[model samples]
Target: MKFYKISKDSGKKIFHFNSNFIMSRVIQTDKTTNIGCMHLEEGGVIGYHQAVVPQLLLVIAGEGYVRNDKDEYFKVQSGDAVFWEKDEWHETKSDKGLTAIVIESVELNPSLFMPLKK
Candidate 1:
């Protein structure tokens, strides 16, 4: 068991193009099932992208929309949780600055989300 301080996380760009605001990534990886958080400035976008592993997104602060191939989209606000299956191309557009926590854990075995490092 372990604790994580989201406030201390450093942000990086995962992808950006014609995106006015900033889309900062707090964590990104494949070594561990669980991964990062995304902090988007108002009007930010996590441009179209795909992941090899499924991801769970928990909106911590702000609102946005996630659109996919089916032309399907939905509203995402603080406390909202959404699941993105592996290989499903999607784009997250934030009308309001957004801060979201992400959990990229093995779908069948979520226990791995527990921190093993100090």
Candidate 2:
């Protein structure tokens, strides 16, 4: 068992993130899952990218907009959760700054649910 406290100063910034935004990776487990936190200042944008695995973004502070491959945008705020399937293209932006929790899992698969349908 493990416990972690989320803090801005806890993790290292992701080198590939846009300069206007800050992304910190807090936890990684055996190449299967990753947990991170991101902060987007006003006018900041996270460039479009395809998800390598299933992901969930949980907005914890402020507000922002998420853009999908179809060019559609969705407004999100604190307590809002967004899910992205593997290989889905998406991006994010914030006009008033935003903070969120990011969770990704490469090993999660449909097979895991097969036994639950019983």
Best by lDDT: 2
- lDDT per residue, candidate 2, 43-96, as tens digits? 877778888899778889999999779888989999887778899988988999
lDDT of each: 0.68, 0.79
What's the TM-score of each model vs. the native? 0.69, 0.77
Model 2 residue runs over 4 Å out of place are 1-5, 9-19, 107-118
Instruction: Show pairs that collide, candidate 2.
Output: none
Encode model 1's per-residue lDDT on 33-88: one tens digit a residue. 65567787777887777755787777889999987666777888997777778887
For every candidate in turn, the CA RMSD to the true structure comes to: 6.9, 5.1
> Which structure among the candidates has the greatest TM-score?
2
lDDT value, residue 61 of candidate 1 = 90
**Which runs in model 1 stand beyond 4 Å of their true positions?**
1-5, 16-31, 108-118
